[model samples]
Target: MFDYIIKNTSLPEVGVKNTIQLLNDACTIPFISRYRKEATGNLDEVQIGEIVKFKEQFETLEKRKATILKALEEQGVLTPELQQKVESAPDQTILEDLYLPYKKSRKTKADTAREQCLEPLAKIIMSQKTNDLESVAHRYIKGDLNSVDDALEGARHIIAEWINERTDVRNNIRYQLERFATITTKVVKKREAEDEAQKFRDYFDWSESLSHIPSHRLLAILRAENESFIRVKIEIDDDRALDKIFQRIIKSNNACSDQIEIAIKDAYKRLLLPSLSNEALQNAKEKADEAAITVFAKNLKQLLLGSPLGEKRVLAIDPGFRTGCKVVCLDAQGQLKHNETIYPHPPKNDSTGAIKKISTLAEAYKIEAIAIGNGTASRETEALIRRIRFKNDIQVFVVSEAGASIYSASKIARDEFPNYDVTVRGAVSIGRRLQDPLAELVKIDAKSIGIGQYQHDVDQTKLKTQLDTVVESCVNAVGVNLNTASKSLLSYVSGIGPKLAENIVNYRDEHGAFSSRTELKNVPRLGDKAFEQGSAFLRIKDAQNPLDDSAVHPESYHIVKSIAKNEGKRVSELIGNSSILKSIDLKVYCTDSTGLPTLQEIVKELEKPGLDIREQAKVFTFNQNIKTINDVQEGQLLPGIVNNITNFGAFVDIGIKESGLIHISNLSDGFVSDVNAHISLHEQVIVKVLEVDIPRKRIQLKLHK
Candidate 1:
């Protein structure tokens, strides 16, 4: 099905069937090559992910075809030929064409013409080989069509309306417009408008590759257009496009080529061009949406996997003024150890007391790190920490508390800390977030993460749906710890919801800790379907069924036990032995019910049992000496951490609050196609400082030669 779409549709090669299979199987690029070995010939994740997206689009098109067919059939217009056309429609644009006449619309010129009793004349002109357009005009020149010229004009109007009404013509024109259109944005001259769109100043003369324009930029241009501060037009060469369509129509009707030419030109100028241009712009917007979602997903992944300070006790401070500074200490597992308030910044201004209290807590709890919220008087708090000169080894870092307040006021926070004050809860969350970002972050809304670009500008429902999917995929991809996971984390599990997740937690609390994943079924409301979806993803470190600790689904237990028996060992003994497992002939296990594909996966998981699928969270220690951009010099090779890898670039951490951008072009001295090929997530690479802009907080770095 996917192959047929790829061959017939305008979808690129990157969007293919095999690629989607690799992605759907969750086989890592390295694993796919090392294990599957034969399948895919080892295409990497990047390649596979692209293909998967393409396959999804193909499937979407198929669904749309079915919908169009049903709607047309309901209207009694679905002829055999029309049905075939609908089924074979190559893309969404064409599929929409098959539905357009039946599609709901307000009021149209063709409808108006039909209402005015000019349907027959319109139909004759649409046939194109009119015996005489003048004669046809003469026939309709009675009521509304007054004179010969008026009748001819009305006939031209009717023909244009009919041409536009044909779904095929509209679809063709839309495609042509998208292929040839340029998004031309021009400033409305400050004096002409209120200039409320100052953010779009750079876009005043911008003309982007219509297919590749980023969503944020597209939204900005649209906002400018909406506010009337900029006039944005989707310009296409109408004459050239009309000529191409006319060539097709004229070839079909050779005798009326001249009349058809006039009609085609009139259709484009009066009807087709305007409507199709709007459709093309909408197509451009959808393209932008896809790209934006891709970028946002990548960034969200990076943010979710951002280096966790690891499981270490932390002291967090919410720097403040009149109310003083709130201080909270959390243990290695993020449990609140203590809480207090010290007058640090203004009003009370007890800097000495703050320093003494922080140092005492650091020494007493042996706090591994101190997280100071980057809010009001954060710098002053950091300065106070520096002045204390603690005897114990403690690291102090300034953390962004973007959503700390939101979490503080949230019901979840209140539930987590029923006894503590909201401000103290906020401070504790800030501290714990640095320790285990995924765990702490799951407690808060994803939108508050501040990683998205123009997140507010996109369709809120769609944005939420897309972001929620990303979060769910990320959560499931990295199996959750059943004992430690919060309800928010559990809620994200497939087929699980807030109510069920809460029930699971309450059940755990009411009873003892669940020794096995199967026990989840015993929990109220967690039925067979929910268990099937959630069980494979939830991990218990030392469960009764060892398979629960690993990704091996329960349904594959019989196959695993048979393999164990064949090896002359118990199932538990074969859990983590790679040598014995690799020697077993996988062909022996392959059967009709258990195919080679699934059996191979089961064998691999058994060899390295209970492996955490998530990329290991790294602990990064910043070089405090290199606080400012000016502290670094050109040609100085410094050790930096790879923070993210995108198609266009990689962001590297150079011990500063802001990460430096290492564009793909600057990644290496050799030809590099992908940023991932050159660097990976959390990779420690040596980089040379290329340039720094302190004002903009931007740094440019090049990987060391």
Candidate 2:
């Protein structure tokens, strides 16, 4: 079944088996790749990620097929042949075509005419070789069908509508229309005053293949259309379309070829064209959404998996005016050490006091860093901190407080700091976020994280669904610390929710600590399914269960224990034993239900234990010297980090606030199309600067050849 699906679909060959196994085991893609490397040929995180997405899409298509088949079966129209065809349909589009006749719809003209007893005349006209179309019209020439011309017109209309309803005709026309369609976008010059229209001004007279337009450009055009600043219409060649349909009908009969031609043209102009155009538009929209969602997911994953600065003594300041700069100091473990309010900006302003407070706090606590919220007065506050110049060196940096206010008023924030004021909590969160971004950032909603494009414009429900999945994948990829993770973080765990997450936290609070991953079952509402999905992703470092310290699932514990016994050692000693593991007979313990496939996986994980799934690196601090495009020099070699990689190019972080583009052509001395083939995420590389545009903040680079 897995092989058949893989052959039928576009899934990559590298991780297909492991992906199928992961889906069956209910293990997430993150868990499988991070913990089961040997089982998956050591496929990198990205390839496995793609396989996971394909598996989900395949499952969704299967469910859709089942629903369609049942609907047809209940209608008593499901034949064995039809059922086989529907089941074997390759994609949702084909399945929908098979089910079109049975699918429910709103009132249509053909159905109304059939109700009026015009079916015989309509069928005769469709046959087109009857003694005469006039004779057929004579039978239905009554009431609304009065007069020969009226009757013929009604019959022709019915024939046209019937031809339109044919699934084959509709599908063929839709395909042709998509292939031949040109999306034309026009904007009214007068309505371009709105700030929203500025982005679309360059696209006012745009025309492109419906199938080839990029998602971002398509979305921009759609936004312009919605605002009425632009009128977009998809155009196709009518003659080619008419000829295609006419040939199909004409081949059947030569007697009424002209009548059929008229009918075909009418069907296309009135019925097929409009409906298929709408479908084409919808297809374009769906493709755009998928691409946009994929990009959004990738960016979200990177942002979530960003290297944590780790717990450090941090001084947080919410640079402000009316309330003064609210300051809070957190210890290395994020406990509030002290809090103070110093007026620095305006009104009861005292720069001296503010500087004194910050310096004193830095010196006394030996603060390693100061996190200043990037709000109205952040730069001013940073300047003040720089001037104060504490004797004990402290690095001050601006931190984006995009959702700081939202978190401050949130219930989780209140519960975490019941005694502290909202302002102080916000300040502390800002400071802590810089120290450990993944931990503190998880406290806020993923949507509020500021990584998406047109996030507000897209469907909120769909965006949330995709973004939530991304957050879950990222959170699970880097296994969360059971002791330190917040409920917000735990809630993203597969099979866990806000309520269950709270229950886990409360259970831990009441009891001392989670000694092992299996202890989660003790928490109320955490059932077998939740445990199966969430256990592999939650780590209890230095815990009682050695497997918990590693990513090996609880279900595989007995297998590892047996292996350990075979080696004449405890399970603890068996971990990290490559030679001993290779000597074991994996098939000896494999059962009919639990195949060797899963058993082999269990053995491989035991070889390398307690692997930290997250990227291994220290927190990266951008160089102060390279802060803008103007700061970059042509032909200068700069040490940088690869931020993103795509087929066409790579975006690198060169210590400038903005990332630079390294096109694939410039990536190496040899030919290269895929950026990933040469560069990877977080990989540090040296590149010679090629071009720099200060106004656009665009820097182009070529890799060191």
TM-score of each: 0.79, 0.79
**Per-residue lDDT tens digits of candidate 1, residues 1-705?**
666645654444443444446556543332332234335434444444445555667788888888778878888988999899888887776677566656756776555556667667656655766666676567666766577666444455656655666776776766666576788887788634344565567877778666556566787788777777778777777777877777666654543455456767888877677777777778777666665566566667656665568778899998888888899888887888899999977787778887888888998888988888767766567778878887877877766676788888899998989998889988998898788667777777766766545555556666676677667766766667787788988888766879999999999899978899889999999888677667877888778778889877776788889988988988999988888888888888776555566677778888887565555443444455575577876667777776655556777777656778887789988788656567765577888878887776788889885
Model 2: lDDT of residue 592: 46
Give the whole-model CA lDDT for all candidates, comma-separated.
Answer: 0.72, 0.76
RMSD of each: 5.6, 5.2
Per-residue lDDT tens digits of candidate 2, residues 275-303?
78988988898777776666666666666
